[model samples]
Target: MIEEIRIQNLGVIGRAHVQLGPGLTVLTGETGAGKTMVLTALSLLLGGKADPATVRTQAQAAAVEGRVVLPADAPALVRAEEAGAELDDDGSLLLVRTVGAGGDGGSGRSRAFVGGRSVPQAVLGELAQALVTVHGQADQARLRSPAHQREALDAFVGPQHRETLGRYRTAWAERARVDTELTELVERAQDRSREAELLRLGLGEVERVDPQPGEDVALAEEAERLAHAEDLRAAASGAHAALTGDEDGGTDAVSAAAVVEHARRLLDQAGTHDPTLAALATRVAEAGYLLADASTELGAYLEDLQADPRRLEVVHQRRAELGTLTRSYGADVAQVLEWAAASGLRLLELEGGDQRIEELRATRDGLDASIAELARTLTLGRAEAAQRLADVVSQELTGLAMAGAQLQVVVEPADAPGPHGADRVEMLLVPHAGAPARPLGKGASGGELSRVMLALEVALATAPHDDEARPGTFVFDEVDAGVGGRAAIEIGRRLAELARGSQVLVVTHLAQVAAFGDRHLVVTKSTSDGVDVVTESDVRPVEGEDRVRELARMLSGQDDSQAARTHAAELLELSSVGR
Candidate 1:
C-alpha cells in the first residue's frame, strides 16, 4: 500500500506532501482545488508518461515520489529483489520519478529509481500492476473487455482451477509442437526422397575416398621424396665419390681405411699433447666407415632410381579426392569421417515408414486427449465461478444505487483452442428490469461502471487466485463523479468495506462520501509567494466546530451558513452509526 506521496513543481502543486493511511483515504475539494494533481502524481509514480508542461512555470523540473509498504508475502518484493532494488527489512519500497524540461517539445525525460538503483520504467510499471489497481473513467469502461472478463473469471475460480488451466495450457503447447512436426513430415515427404538420394551419394563418395587420419601427412612426405628423387640420386652419387675413391679413377689411391690408420699413428706419436688432432683422427675413422657403407648403398640405388608415372598419378588422384571432400564438408580427413556418420543417421530418420507415422500419431492423440479433457474441466470451473461472481456483483450493485441492475458473466465457446482454454467470457449488465441484457459497456452509466468496477474489485480481493498476493490497493479517480446523496454514501460504504481487506483511495466531490473516510484530505488552492499552488490537509478526526465548518464549506460552498453546518453534523453523526 502507498504510505506517502510527495509532489514538487507538478502542475498546480508546488512542494506538497500528502501522507496516506492504511485504509480508505478520501480526497475532496472545490472544482479547481487541484484534486486531479494528486492523481497525476500517482500516475507518474506508477510509471505513467511525464510532460514538461506539468512542471510549474518557474520550476526547472517536476518530481513525484512514493513510499509503499508491502505485505510479507507480496510478489512485488520478489520482483523488486530480482530487479536489484533495495528493500528495507520490513518489506518497504520506495519509487521516485523526475521529469525535466523538454528540449524539443517532447515531454521532459523521465526516470524511475527503485530503492536507490536506477530501473527501467517497464520494471516499475510491472511492480505497480501488482501493487495498485487504478480505476479511472476509461479503466471502468475497460472492465467490459473480454480479456478482462476472462482474467476476472480465472481469478474468481481460485488456484486449483488455475493450476489445472496451467497444466492444460502446457499440454496444449506440447501438442502444437508435435502437430507442427507431423505436418512438416507430411509436407516434405517428397522433398526428403530427393534429399535422401543426395545424402546417400555424399556418404558413398566420402566412404570411397577412405581418407584415413594422419594419412594426408604421410602421403605428402612420400610425394615430396618422390618428386626430388632425381636430385637425391645425383647428390648421393657425388657424395659417395667424394667420401670413397671411384674404382681405378681417383688419386690418393689408398683406401679410406688406410688413410685413417696413418692419421691414427701420427696422433699416437704426439700423445695427449695434441688432443684436438687425436679427436680429429677418431672422427675421420668413423667418417671413413660411414662413407664405405654409403658407397655400397649408392651402387644399389642407381639401379632403382627411376620414377613410376602410374604411382605418381595414383597419389595425385587420391589427394584430389581427399581435397574435394575436405573443401565441401570437413576441415580435414577426420572431420569428413564424422560428418559421414551423422548424415547417415539423419538420412535414416528422414526415411520414415508407416510404423514411424503411427508412433507419432499415437503420441499426438494422447496429448490431444489430455488437453481436451483439461479444457473441459477448466470451462466447467469457470462456469461455476462466474455464477457465484454474478451473484456477488449483483448484490454490490444494489448498494451502489443500482438496485435494478443485473450483472452476469457470459461464457461462450472459443473460436479455436487457445492457451486460456476453450471458452470466451464477457460481463453483461441489464440496468433495469425488462431491459435487454447488453454488455457492460453498452448500457452501464459512468457511475454504474464505477460501481461495477468496485464490486468486481471487491469480489476479486475476497477470492484471490494466488496466495502470493491479495489485492493491495485500489484507486478510483472521480469514480463518484456524477453521484450524490445516498448513492455517494453507498460508494463510501463500499470503499470502506473494500478497505477492510485492502487499502483504497477515492477522489470525490460528494461530502457524504468524503465524510465517511477513515482519513480525509482537502486539496485547496492558495497563493504561495505570488504563485498559485495546490496543497493538501488531513481532515480526519476533525473536531466539533471545525468539522462542521469544513463539511458545510464542502456542501454549500459557504462556510458561514448555519443550515449547512447543521446538516453536516447530522450527516457525520448518521455516518458514524452506520459505519
Candidate 2:
C-alpha cells in the first residue's frame, strides 16, 4: 500500500505532497488545475517511461517518491532485499524516480531507486507487478486484444490452472528443443557418413604402423651410429692403442698407463724423504687406474663395432616409413599417436550416427506425446475457467448498470500449439437478449468497454488465489470516462467494494465517483508573478464544507452555488448508503 507520494517539478505540478491510505482515495479538480499530474506522478513511481517534455518549464528535473508498506513475505520485498535495499523501521519501502531535463536539445535521462538504493529502471518494473495494478483508458483499449483477454481469464482461474499452464509451457519448450536436434541429425546424415569413412581410413593406417612412444628418437640415434660404423671403429681402436702398450704394433712408444705407473713408483721412492712426495705418488696411482679402465672399455667398443650393410639398410627403411607417417599425420611419432587416440573416439561416434538419429527420433516422439497431452489439459482447464470467469464478470457487469449485457469467453482451437497453448481465447459481448455475440472491439462502446475492464479487474482481484499473485494496490485513472448517471454511481460503488480488500486510488471528474472516496484530495492551480513568474499546483485533502464546495465545483461551474452544494451533499449521502 502506498502511504504517501511526493512529486516535484513534474508537468504543471511544481510541488505536491499527497497522503494516501488503505481505501478509495479520489483526486478531483478543474480541467486545467493539474489533476492528471497526480496520476502522472504515480506512473513515474511505477516505472513508466519518462519524457523531458513532461518537466515543468525552467525546472532542471522532475522527481517522484513514494512510500509503500509491504508484508514480510511479499515478493517485492524479497526482490528489493536481494538488490541490497533496506526497509524502514515501519516496514515501508521507499521508491524514487527522477527524470532529468536533457541539456542542448538531447533526450531526457531517467533513474530509479528502491528502498534508498539505486537500481535499474527495469527492476522498478518487476516490483510494480506485485506492488500495484494501474488501469486507465489505455487498459480499456488493451481489453480488446485477444492476448489480453486470455491473460485476464488465466489470472482468474487461480493457482491450479496456472500450474497446468506452466507445465504445458515447459513441455512445449522441451519439444521444440528435441525437434531441433532431431532435424539437424537427419539433415546432416551424408556429411556424418563421409566423416566416419575418413576416420576409419586414418585409424587403419595408424594401426598398421603401430608406433610406440619415443621410437622415433631411438631409431634416429641408432641410424646415425650405423651410418658411421667404420669411422667409429677406427677412432675407438686408436684411443685403445694410445691408452695401453701397442703390443701388436711392436712400437717402443710408452703407453699412458705405463708412463703413469713409472711416475707413481718414482714418487713412492722419494716419499721416504718428504711427505709432499707421498701425496703426489697417491695421485699418480689414481690416474694410472683410470687410464687402465678406459683402455679396457675402448677395446670392448672396438670388438663390438661391426659394419653390417643389411642392418643399416633396415634402419634406413624404418626411418623412411616413420617419415611418411609423420608427414601425413603429425610432426613426430608422439604427436601422431595423440591424434590417433582422439580420432579413434571421434570415429566411434561418427559410426554411431545412425543409431543416435534413431534414439533422438524416439526422444522427439516422446516429447511430442507429452506436449500434446499437456496441451489438451490446458485447453480443458481454460475452457472450464473461461465459463466461470464469464459468469463472474457478467454478474459484475449487472451491478455496473449493464443488466441485459452478457460476457462470453470463447476458447477456440488454434491450428497448432503455441507457446501459450493450443487455444485462442477471446471475449465476446451480447449487449442484450436475442442479440448475437460479437467480439468486444466490435460490439461494446467506449463506456461499455471501460465497465467491462473494471468488471474483469474486480473479478480477478476477488478470485481465490495466493496473496503473491495479487497486487497490493490498484489505481484507476478515469476508468469512469464516457460513463455518467447511474452507471457512474455503480462504477464508484464497485470501486469502493474493490477497495475493501486493497488500496485504491482514482482520478475522477464525476461528483458521483468522488463522493465514494474515503479520502478526497483537490488539486488547486495558482499563478504567481515576481522576479520570476511561474504557475504552480498544490494538492490537499478536503473535508466537511471544503469537500462539498469542491464537489460542487465539479458538479457545476460554481462552487458557491447553494443548489450544487445541496446536490453534492445528496450524492455523498447516496454513496454512503450504497457503501
Per-candidate TM-score against the hidden true structure:
0.82, 0.82
Cα-based lDDT for every prediction = 0.80, 0.87
Which one is best on lDDT? Answer: 2
| Candidate 1, residue 402: lDDT | 82
RMSD to truth, every model = 4.9, 5.1
- How well is each residue in 1-579 modelled by candidate 1, as lDDT tens digits? 899989888888877788887787888777767778889999988888877788877677888889999866678878887889887666679889998866554457788889878999888888888888888887876786888888888988898988898899889888888888788777877888888899989998987888888777677776776788889877876655555655543435555545666776777667578888778768766766776687788777767776766777777778888899989888888888889889989888877644567777899999988988999999999988888999999888898888888898988898997988999898999887788889886777777787888888888877756754455888888888777878888887888888886788888777787777777777778887887787543222344686678789988989899999998887788666223
Provide the lDDT at 106 for model 2: 43
- Residue by residue across 418-478, what tens digits does model 2's lDDT show? 9898899999998777888999978889899989998998899888788788898999999
Give the 10-residue window scoring lowest on summed lDDT in candidate 2: 528-537
Ten contiguous residues minimizing lDDT sum, candidate 1 = 535-544
